[model samples]
Target: MKPISFIWILSVWMSLDFIMHGASTDPFDFDQVIHFKIEIPDAGIEILRQSNFQRRWPDSSHRPKVKAEVRINDEPFKDVSVRLKGAAGSFRSIDSKPALTINLDSHIKDQQFEGYDKFYLNNSVQDRSYCNEIICRELFQRAGIPTPRATHATVELNGRDLGLYVMIEGFNKKWLKRHFDQIGGNLYDSGFLKDIHANLTVNVGKNPEDHSAKNNLIAAVYEKDLSKLLPGIMRHLDLDMFLTHVALDTLTWNWDGYAMKPNNYRLYHNLDTGKFQFIPHGMDQMFQNPQGSIYPRFRGVTVLSLMRLPAMQQQYFKRMLHLYGTVFKPKQLVNRVDQLAAVIEPELKKRSLREWDRNQRGIQRLKDSIGARGDFLGWELSAPERALKFPDAGFVSIRNWKTSRLRGDIQFRNANENNKQVLVIESGSGINIGRWYSQQLLTQGTYRFEARVRCENVVAAPNDLYGGVRVRASGSRINAVLTGTRNWTWVAADFLVSQPVEEVELSCEFRGMQGRTWFEEGSLRLVKLR
Candidate 1:
């Protein structure tokens, strides 16, 4: 089999020639909407309907592709394979205009669509403004992160006019060549709410069985010692680039990205440097929570572990400041959104007046959020760091927790146990992640959190991601849990506060079905490590 290739140098020359000769032709143009018409046979449409009817997340084995004829801006491409694509938030049935993945060279070898072999047509349900993806991608690219290009499109499938969609460049061999100098590596997709610790499916690779690169990266992230954590991670990751990615994610308020959640991302193990690089995806929801924390609670294992070090924390903050000063321009972004709306809103109005109204309102909201985000980021970056107060004993007893019912029915109250006011959490009939959490402002340092707990009939929730009944601080790598019947034994987890001052959440959570757990009062304490 011949290795897939993209003529990078020739493409560069053509780009220069186009610029020099003032040619009005270029692919991946974001200034205008590209009209796409897809003609699939009845059998192909049925296959798509069946695929969309499943309504499950996109995976390798479940989604099947059917042949179709595609036309882009009046240009034709026959013998293409089209498959329905989306996760939980953006998925729609074929009748309701589903998202699609169009592969140009699947059946026809060496076929290209405007110098691209594959592309995505996103159903812009999550982003009513239809501008977040492009804006966020531009921000990431400006911040020196290798992100895929995105633009607006109006797609018509089988004569049924689907409304405006966000057309994104696909992560194929051409994309790899475009971004990297060397292209021999594995590309792993963060499939459907999965993290790096799970078995991530390889999207592009030479040998799927050889997963040493990914394993090494995970092992580095799992390093327990704070002293060795950054060095270990640096061995397997492009640390600076990764930190820049995190900074951009934070500035954009990408709540669903790799820095916040372990979803909507891609990891590429670069062969030239033997390091992993993160790529952001599913960014339609960026900037939604404009005032969300700059110091976000990281959920990804890699970021959580590296963030435990004070040096890494400082570097992260510095990167955020740099990117904010350089790449994040609120007025420019809002103007871009206006420009996009001007081009897309008319097309949208032609489709549905109701949709156009909704989109206009959404666009206004999006612009306001972008401006608010810029103000918030400026204030956060300019504020002076405050040092937290600690006693001479270097320890504090935790108290005054608020109850949070995450799922199902959970009862929380204070009770007398062994002559002490113990906090109790009782689970109802269904499974729950009942938590009694307290937040405290703390300075940068290492600390150990300990709580004496006793449990009764603590049946662990099936596939519980947080373990069983346990006392832990948010964003900590400590794994300590107590299940079933147990005496008043101390359960402890070590945590490191990396910021100058941060509000850390200490949680006594019971993640189980039908369990009663008691956390002995006056025993919950945080002791500074150094």
Candidate 2:
């Protein structure tokens, strides 16, 4: 009847950690491997501010100085020494000096993972976590990308063991903050934006008509022209090198890499030398999204999306193919896959068989219970193909709306008779037409609706003809409208049903009679909200 105590839990957890970190027969003992750490002095902050102030676009100021220590059996190795080297710059207000230098023995026993062990040691696969930015940065540099240099070390204390330390070059902050300010602070909403140290004055310009609360702040410090600084930054970047990194990122399922928001990229400018550069930093949560997801699909850059933007996407893709091709053979991707799988599989297998069996069994049981009821009802991937070819057919058919084309033929096929389709007619006299129909109805709930549409030589003003998927409950309705230029685009909207209705309706309304519009494939499926 006694309650569990915190110390008791800690003891049990430590016992498990011991088992996981036990010595292995393999030549390399991953358990004993001590990743590196870095520490930045307060003076280093000023140098980072001045150098990166304007150039570090989309990022915040404050680059912590990094240092790595080597460890064996949880003890620092005293005999080993360490030194840091890279691009030179002022550490305080003085002239530029070596990036960093420190004696490992001077701070051996003091180094530890600090507050991160809970997430890294407890929430990791195989009891391993690349919780260290030093390791991530090293991988980036070795991949031939323009990354800051990183160094490792070993240190020892009087009665303890050896440990590892890592050091990495810091980035400019002034440049990054400027960009964030220019973009209206929307960049902060992204998961990629981190380490927000200070706040800047909010500046809203004269024109309030075209700005939102978000844009005002960023536009205040926005640089109108970036081309002037692109050249110098490109010199160090090697577009090919950066693109190669992106490609490897995709192959590795490095979801974290692609998870960046548009604002995370920084643009550096050396005013004295008239040089400009683009730099990528912050890899703390790198290498996520190894495979695709089924739910609200993981948001990140993908080969598919990249390929869609033929011009810019093609250039980046070719660079990746070319660079990766030079270093690895055609079969190298397969080999790399095997190597990564070998590294991760053993740990995952053990967890699946021992630690996660209960959870896995519960998920499997739930899946079986749902059975055919869980099948997804929505638009097919091939709907685009059918839409492009037919050009005037409803991908999803709703009942009741009349289809009359002053220009093209439109067809509606109904899978169920109870859904309503309404069309709106707009004329110069402010007159509109509305149609109503009814059939069998399903219970009100959240549903996934999708439509593939194309506009052909359509001339319409913003208030003119617009087509969309609509959901209605009682007499109230919510519509997700698709209105833009005469091009194909996908639009989605989430709607909630607060009341019960006997039928569903799909309606298109025309604000004016003079405009023309076309509809292709459309579909909707009712789904239970979790």
Candidate 3:
């Protein structure tokens, strides 16, 4: 064979091999930013506008697909379905811009562009930084949780510029493939699973109709055999993964997820392991402020139930500390923000000067968060076991307290013929419950809660209604209940605060009783040992 012929043949073979076996485009490669355009037809835009009214009026609400053209880096693509998306944050039906969902398959046959079948073009109407979802999703992915990737896009409809938008990866079968080897399995979109017991919507799976996995998981959570609950949960669920996911959400303060409410997450019955896994979704809001605690105190029932166990709680705190040290690095995260901003800033400037200025400030604020958030959380993780000591009587005077009833009278009057004053609760049908609250979240400790109380004619409204003081720990409910009637009585309890923010709130209640009650010398003394 001639040398020139041999060289040409070898080059051809190498090019073919590269085309066949080369890696797919990395969806989350943060160095480069993506700019995409959505060109919806005029009729489609009108339908979207009309759909807004129908969305508000459920009677007329119907999801109708409309064809849209897309351009990626000036590369035109045809046939994408654009639809309005969102529940609460679905504002701007006409102008502010409603969140959008684009189905790529709507235009191309069996098309999987950039390894993603569908994409979510969030208007980001609520986010000031316009990168909360992007940064938070990155945080979760870094912490080993399966989450979506985000980038900024330039959106257009009917030749009209719609400004910059955050293009998010949709949570679907493609997401499952990216996260798990077992692609074809039961995938449930636990979308707004307000009640865990209720059935979850099957988003993508072989047995799309099978809800057995979610049902069994819920049953295990409410299992009667408390001793077997942990083992039972471990059987079908990935506890460590779920806990880490929760910790990531907490660390980022993504309240819209399972921590604040059992929503914005997905459950996948992985075929590879035959076990269910929890994945996070919907992260438009995060790092809003540095005020709230990183630990959610297991506010949701899913975590609440498991965290009640000592072993689970220990593992959670351990994982949290580990993640804090290794994954939640402030400098690296801030660098990521700066990198994304660098790519996005130039395009953002093309939109408008005012927008560029506003977005830059927001980006800087996010960068500031990246610098400061780690230390804030580190302080929380390594918080000392300090004594929540109290002052002498009346020294901790009322910061403030409010009653549930719209119309209730609180009067200061002398009681027991003494000069000491007491807060008197008097009403026709409601009872006087002198409720005192602490100003700050209670940390781990033993608290000595005491109050002087007296009630007259405490009605038995229910099976057994009584006037009492209720102490609620952060992770649990109503640890102790104190009651008194017809005469002066000392209501007190020794509260155990095992979790941070354990003494989150205090409540004094007189359930469905029509009577008068007086309270004085309320004290929440921390009990400590020498």
Off by more than 4 A, model 3: 1-24, 53-61, 94-96, 192-195, 297-299, 370-372, 384-495, 500-530
* Models sorted by TM-score, best on top: 1, 3, 2
lDDT of 1 by residue, 75-164 (tens): 898999899888878878788979999899998898986688888999989999999999999888888888999988889998988979
lDDT of 3 at 465: 33
Task: For each candidate in the order shown, give its overall lDDT on alpha carbons.
Answer: 0.86, 0.33, 0.66
RMSD to the true structure for each prediction, in A, is 12.0, 18.6, 8.9
Q: Which predicted model would earn the best TM-score? A: 1
Give me the runs in candidate 2 sitting further than 4 Å from their true place.
Answer: 1-142, 146-240, 245-259, 262-314, 323-530
C-alpha RMSD (angstroms) for model 3: 8.9
Error of 3 at 522 (Å): 23
Candidate 2, run of 10 with poorest lDDT: 115-124
* Candidate with the larger lDDT of 1 and 2: 1
Q: What lDDT does candidate 3 reach at residue 20?
A: 61
Give the clashing residue pairs of candidate 3, or none.
79-107
Model 2 C-alpha lDDT per residue in residues 1-530, reported as the tens digit of each score? 99999999998988886688553422122322333333333454344434422133434433333333434335443322223222112122212222333334334543322211101111121112213243344445556554543333322322232222233333322223433333222222121332111231222223323324333223322323434233322443234544565554443324344323322333333232222223444443333332232112223322223333334344643444454345423243333323433443343355355433442343233233222211211111112223211113322344333443332222323232234221222223222222222332433345433433333322333453343222333343455443333454444344443222223343333322233333332332223341
* Top-lDDT candidate index: 1
Model 3 lDDT tens row, 43-154: 8877777654333443344446788888766667788777877655644563456677888876687665676768887877676567778877877878777777888877
TM-score of each: 0.72, 0.32, 0.70
Pairs clashing within candidate 1: none
